[model samples]
Target: MIRGPVIETPRLILRPPLAEDLDGFCELMADEDAAKFIGGLQPRAAVWRTLCMMSGAWSIRGFSMFSVIEKSTGNWIGRLGPWQPEGWPGTEVGWGLLTLAQGRGYAAEGASAAMDYAVDSLGFTEIIHCIDPKNAPSIKLAERLGSRKLGEAVAPAPIPHTVWDVYGQTADTWRARRLE
Candidate 1:
């Protein structure tokens, strides 16, 4: 079994999704607000498929989305980690917070922590956050995390939409963040 990386923030724990996380994951994806940029509410089967995909990431690429949990409440909040959509520029750092978890900086915290792990520990030199143009909050989060706008590109067919690439910590940028 391929075990994924675990990251801890001051208020959360990021780990691989367990079988028990399936239901909560479904609920999160079913939320309209959380689903804004993520197409729409997914069927239960789709959520299961996503969980399987996440598991496969560990097996195939040695990394995948980390299930976000509130440290205090110990509740599953959402997910954040490295993902590679075919035809993207590089490994894409992404995050999604449930409706109750929104506006609390959890998304940013999870995303930033994952970015650190990707570059510093995993030796990833290139990372990007692909955000839909209309998702202003996500776009702002990308910028706040020190990502430079890398222009736009049309994603694949099903998602035939243009998204802006938010560049994360490259080797040089990672080095710079360390100095500051």
Candidate 2:
């Protein structure tokens, strides 16, 4: 039997989301600051849907968003991993941190680990980061992942719908010459 991949960083651990994480997941995604780029705080049902979707991704795609826990405190700070949204081309690398977790560089660190796992361990060819144009921090994070702008597209959003696309990159190219 295959066990889930566990990605470790200097201060974080990215592992599969567990049932115990539902409440923490809701709180993180519901935070105003953390949810800004994601449209906004969603209803509890919406949070449940997200959890189910991530779990489904693991079973269907062999990879999914992971619960990001602070190694030192073991607190659930956020999530980061690969997901394929409807109409999207490839697996997208996404991160959502609790409001308190912002500005700590944890998102970037966790996402970098996920990207490496997607490319090196899972052999994925492409990764995308779709971010609202106004979300400058997310845009910078995408660039740090070696992704390039890919224009925008509208889709059903958590709140008022919007279109956003910050970057896309192929694993082979990024692994060879990653952006600075």
Candidate 3:
């Protein structure tokens, strides 16, 4: 498996997924509101597969979402990071946090680090976020990250019925914004 880098932010830790994250994954997926935009609610068994998928992505693809851990509590709050599964529109940095974890700016903090990792380490030239149109909070976060709505794209199978608005910024734009 890919021994991915562990990133420490002031309030969070971004690290690779492991078997131990199953319970946290299930908790996140079980909450309706938290799971709504993220492929709807999933059962525990399916969540196990999700955890396995993220862990295996590290093994097979060399990158995937990192488990977002709250530094103070040392709890797994969510997963957010670089992802570009088969047939994805582009290299992307995505975020998903549990209900309790929302509104704390964790996604933004962790995602910014993930974006840096994607560009600096993963060699991504551009980054995109496939967001549902109705997800106002996510749209705001993407905009906060200096991304604009570039257009729309349908996600890969298991979730092709819905079209997602793609928001993005190039590496140059990201770097320039960071300097400002």
**Model 3 misplacement above 4 A:** none
| Deviation of model 2 at 153, angstroms | 2.5
TM per candidate: 0.90, 0.88, 0.97
* Clashing pairs for predicted structure model 1, backbone only: none
* lDDT minimum window of 10 residues, candidate 3: 1-10
Model 3, position 21, has a per-residue lDDT of: 86
Superior candidate under lDDT, 2 versus 3: 3
Model 1, position 56: C-alpha lDDT score: 79
Which pairs, if any, clash in model 2?
none
Superposition error at 65 for model 3 (Å): 0.3
Let me know the TM-score candidate 2 reaches against the reference structure: 0.88
Model 3 lDDT per residue over 12-56, tens place: 999999788889999999999999898889999999988888888
lDDT of 3 at 109: 95
Ranking by TM-score: 3, 1, 2
Candidate 1 residue spans exceeding 4 A from truth:
157-169
Q: How do the residues 1-180 of candidate 1 rate in per-residue lDDT, one tens digit apiece?
A: 328777889999999888888988899879988977775689899989889878777778878889999999999999889887556567888888888999998998888788888887777887788787788888888888777787676676566554655556476675576467
